[model samples]
Target: MAELYSRRSFLAGALTAGMLSTSAGYFFTRRNKIQLTLATGADPTGGRQLLVSMWNRLNPNVQIQVREVNSSTQDQFLKFNETHADIFNLDVIHIPRFAAEGKIVPIELENDISLVAPVRRVCERTGTDQLWAVPFNSDVGMMFRRVTDKRADAPVTLKSVLAASATGPVTFAGQLDTVGRQTDEAFVCNVLEHALAQDEAILDEGGVLSYGLGQWRDALAPLADAIRRKRVVAAAGEDDTARAFQRDSLRYMRNWPVRYLPLDRAERARPDTAEIRIDRLPLGILGGQSLAVAADSDYRDEAVRAIHFLTDNPAQKLLTSFGFAPTSVDAYIDADLQEALPHLSLVRYAVEGSRPRPIHANYAEFARRFADHTRRHLHDGEELTQQFITDIRSVLR
Candidate 1:
């Protein structure tokens, strides 16, 4: 067994501002036949549906009619646009655009619980005085390597990891392709992470991107080098990388925190490697959904209360136990969770320092353009020149 965690402080109750004996959870009596529609994608973890079931049991009077929007993030997003659900579990990246468009209503958190910093930031609309949602469940990229033993708080850098790749045992892999997917969200995210790791100033306060010589190309050069050296491989997506790493040759791979549980369990079953040490990458890109209330729902107050229940401490603990990364810091440290998913510290650590992918209303189009531009460069030996950067800049607008 291996143990790991990343640098710095987790976001604690920043959404609540100051913590006192205050709770945002509201309960109502079963006076009326009230059923609120919750629109969320089908959850594999089943943690979310369980939360709904638990909430339903508690407040039988005000029941929830869940409308499982079964599909990918793209499909679910489009479904939300077509349907009028009271509560929406939306991708955190989409929250800003939703806020900007007035599609979702404002939400407040229960003051007693502290959300991870990066998760809290994703809930907030930048430069605005409001938060659109409470982080439902959080995801972030992390490097899982089979190590000999846990080290003593050592810093892992992009330079060091890139150097680790040789024509030998452990090769680096990531979700680098758009294989059989409607959108190239994973591909663009990996690219943005590489660039963001090198230069934090690439994007300005308003999320406008600007970069210079070597800042863009230098970061990706090593990846190309590794590909040429046969130390890195093209991946279909996260699932491909996850399955590829199990083959022993691809020991080091970047994947979601939620993946840690299944991977760890599978490794434990096989005992192929010594110990797997999970690391938070520099400029870790965050991913996940947050619970938001529909602006046009009739049951606005009830929906707000449900959001609190779904995201608060109790719900978070259950969700974490079920292999879903939680939003609350307290959920990460819960005694039972400490044993079941010991790597939660790593999740908390990664998310503390993680950041959301580029936020744009036309993010899907940007992803498409980015994939078309970078695929050849990454998969083949083609170079990404200044023209590549210019094309990206044009699409960003």
Candidate 2:
């Protein structure tokens, strides 16, 4: 039966001689368990813990294993393409890059596990939405505050944040992580640029790309100035954003809901220090992760079932319970969760209204240049305001 199935897959893909031998041993057996390897930058053991519990309850026979992938570097999980995995949990920004490379299979969404609009963009961007992966979680950006600094009346907009954080450091990720490619950085950079553009602070309607480029530079100007002025310092990824604020260095921080779940878990696990505070990615744009299935997986039937059970309301609620926002439009409106997680409203608003970075295939190339420009202008005083415009034009062209 294994040989027969292998032959079918080979015929479907027209596997070369070497590839044929590679997949020869691929099939389910009583002794071997079906494996689903998911890649994520932030270790989602808490979320996985809940899913595993539910998965065990639903199907005791099929086994699912979650591998903590350092997506920033792409060293650990990149090989999954050579030997297909059942499912992939991918960073939204990385989707376009992955899709462009044809490394992923198209998703045929099954059951109640419908793909969210934002996540659908991943498929749309990759042109593999219907074929590869089902949208898993719709993560959005959230603003983190120190437990003691929470004033009943706090600033929520970027403009106000700048004013209040003028004298202190506002936090954000400095170094790109495993998944921190150009696309990922663009999500953060573009969000700020989008807001600044709307305020007439950056970008113009000519669509010259120069105008947009100018806005991006201008948008980052204040934040860069803030950092130079000792008002903003790069926080340690999303995980440290919350704690960095607690240390009195960061008065304001922007991060994803997933990064802070561990902080929340720590709060529950040990209530010693202080309660972490969260809000949306500051009335700007946000990004998230989605789930996709291997186009070549034999367990498509079971894979679809697992996806459905993992993304619905019950699963989303479980996510919310762990301090991560749900992608479901309903979860965005859930008053209880909103009250529990102050950032929930922000995430919902961002998701409904947030814009992703340029969906072009060249985004990865663009991101590399953008980050270099940011470092040069923000760190090295390389006159990025004008040079940025020229460089982006060079890349876009």
Candidate 3:
């Protein structure tokens, strides 16, 4: 992760000015300047803003504006029903759904920097030979442990992980409340990871579920224990979970890359604690955002140009300087850029090996089913059935 102090120096001077050398042939003159909108979540690192500002200056005729996108994944999907903006920044998991619905159009997303394989895979529509989006950043789930813990690694089984923490089993406290009433992506990702671990073919590209009935009990035993024990911290969301993890006397946390900053700081202030990362999990879930052109937009070609600028080599490096994981494999090649992220090695491990959550047009619904069913079975002790797997296919539309 890029420390705040390091980010300031890394983005200090030439980083903003270096783009003045972009080819003039690709941009129109200032007199022909036109505006385009980019919808993306707000980044605390301010890297997103920097990339846009740089693009505007170099390609004055193709000036871009940033629109603060909705934080809710469902809300973002709804906005995609029509051309909400010229450029849509989508969570990688949503790409398949949005592309299938024609909310985002297919474009041969070319990149000057070769993106990581896992990152590249999410940009594509499942079961198709077409690319629908360009990866903007990369994320992967990891198990964090306190250095004081006797277990040097993540516990072998789900049960062992629950008891690893000193303060009850709040270890997996992130989104524990998503049990009964579903719709939480974190909870869904957790269930999907375990299922994938059991059998890679459990879910097909069309969103069909086909694992053994016993797989449900085996896959969600930990969730059941968490509910019965009521040991999970009641975190409202991801940010709240991070804060709660910092405050709780817990030994393990499952979260994304950006967590290193806050966790590291918390450990620094605590006299008896230090954090270490267990990046190599049995399987890690892919998490990140991608850029796509809106299907209804009149400026499809122009939007594609904006996508190129935002994901170009320099912009990716600038995002790296601000602590965002680079989707581009080339970002790691720069020695200075590597220094900005102290946890680059682990980040590499997680990103390269991470697997996407089940791909479906109605992916959010698919996520809800897994989250809802897991909670249902745990609450009522309902065993998985062949009908249950059959019903999972209903989410295809």
Quick one: ranking by lDDT, best first? 1, 3, 2
The model with the greatest TM-score is 3
Over the full model, what C-alpha lDDT does candidate 1 score relative to the true structure? 0.69
Better of 1 and 3 by lDDT: 1
> Can you give the lDDT of residue 53 in candidate 1?
71
Cα deviation of 175 in candidate 1 (Å)? Answer: 0.7
Question: Per-residue lDDT for 260-288 in model 3, tens only?
Answer: 65467557567666455445455677888
What TM-score should be assigned to candidate 1? Answer: 0.83
Q: In candidate 1, what residue range of length 10 has the lowest lDDT sum?
A: 4-13
Candidate 3 residues lying further than 4 Å off, grouped into runs, are 1-4, 11-14, 17-26, 125-130, 148-160, 163-172, 179-183, 195-209, 231-236, 275-278, 379-387
Query: Residue pairs in steric clash, candidate 1?
Result: 11-117
- Model 2 agreement with the true structure over 1-397: per-residue lDDT tens digits: 2443343334323312322233222223345466555444454445645565556444545666665554452232354444456677765655655666766656565444444465455455344436345555666555655454334535455556655567644443322221354234633453344345345433222112334655565666766665566555454344444555545434356666666645544543333435556664433443566676665668766666666666655566556656565767665666655545555666666666555554544555666666666666665666656666666566555
Task: Estimate, for each residue in 118-154, the C-alpha lDDT of model 1 and write its tens digit.
Answer: 7787677566645688888888778877554345334
Worst 10-residue stretch by lDDT in candidate 3? 174-183
Of the two candidates 1 and 2, the one with more favorable lDDT, higher being better, is 1
CA lDDT scores, all candidates in order: 0.69, 0.53, 0.67
Per-prediction TM-score: 0.83, 0.72, 0.84
TM-score comparison, 1 vs 2, better candidate: 1
